[model samples]
Target: MALLDADARHPITLPDGTLYRDTVYLKNVIDHPRIKVGDFSYYTHSGKPEDTAAILAPYLGHSVRERLVIGKFVQIARGSYFITSSANHPMTGFTTYPFRIFKPETFGYKDLPVRDTVVEHDVWIGHNAAIMPGVRIGTGAIVAAASVVARDVPPYAVVGGNPASLIRMRYSDDIISELLSIAWWDWSLDKIEANLDALTLGDMEALRRA
Candidate 1:
């Protein structure tokens, strides 16, 4: 039997064996031009599956310059959202108020700088976390519940709190580097399944041999 189905829209099954409709595979649910989600990345929410894109990144419009790139195996909890560069108001002027957006013809801050928001592979974002514009969350990072992430999160680090400070590193620098080199998330599903014990057990020797 397969461990998981990447194509399944509602991937989670409750203990009672009923499909958990609140959780959806982001790639299967989202069709936004500005958003890119890798296979097996899922987000939990109570809204309709079709509204996944809007709910995940509310400010990312079709015509917006910025992009939201999420990598494989990302687990996003409920109420977590990305505030992309498109949501930023013009800060070059004296006042931050968006006067041009009032009119349809000049309804944007086209001159403002924009940057893509990137969440790398194997990242686990906890509930109610808000990722600020253009923040690059590194691979294997953990964002704790209710965090207001305003800066980049290093790989394998556990971050929490309002400004999302690093709580601790999951592994030493060498181990993190080795894991990055291994890049288990890029492995084929069969290989990943075959090596599940090493991954789950945190046996570096076994993983290295695999």
Candidate 2:
């Protein structure tokens, strides 16, 4: 059972105040059994599996074996979906239809030759974006709204469009290297709180000094 709170309409909050409604919590919509989500990641969904079916449908139907691994501090906007590997049909055969699917003896969907999709820490996937199977989004990268990401995103890159091409890097090579070295997301909570000014104010020098 979910813990009900008097504050929100749905009121079933997660340990980190995620998954609530009426004030930005939608705990009801995160019902997928196969997705492995990291801590402090937020999902904005209506609490329905079908509503976010691109990620869950193949798994629910037992058609995919690949997992969607999300890292901590990732921000997933509403309507974002993951296209699993099982959605791929054998193209080497004469027909696109899966003849194996009809046979009870071979009814299981074969695993594709694709790695599991992974969203690394501190990534921000924008609203309604589609992350294709086997894609790896690196840390601190941003996927623009409605983009379709089919390729791997490098760290701190901003990507957009149907194929999700890179628009720009968040920082110069020197700054990126320094920032990656710092890895603020991995810092302790007390340290993070102490350096809130540097984080919020974009004080790179202060962060470097820390």
The candidate that wins on TM-score is 1
Off by over 4 Å in 2: 1-34, 48-64
lDDT (tens digit, per residue) of candidate 2 on 48-158? 444554433344343356667788668778778788776677777688887787899886556437578899888988999988888999988999999999999999999
lDDT of 1 by residue, 1-210 (tens): 789898899998989999899999999989999899999999999999999998999989999899999999999999999999887888877998988888999976888888899999999999999999999999999999999999999999999999999999999999999999999999999999999999999999999999
TM-score to true structure, per model: 0.98, 0.78
Error of 1 at 161 (Å): 1.1
Q: Supply candidate 2's per-residue lDDT for 209.
A: 81
How good is model 1 by TM-score?
A: 0.98
Error (Å) of candidate 2 at residue 147 is 0.4
Candidate 2 has an lDDT of 0.72
- Candidate 1 wrong stretches, greater than 4 Å: none
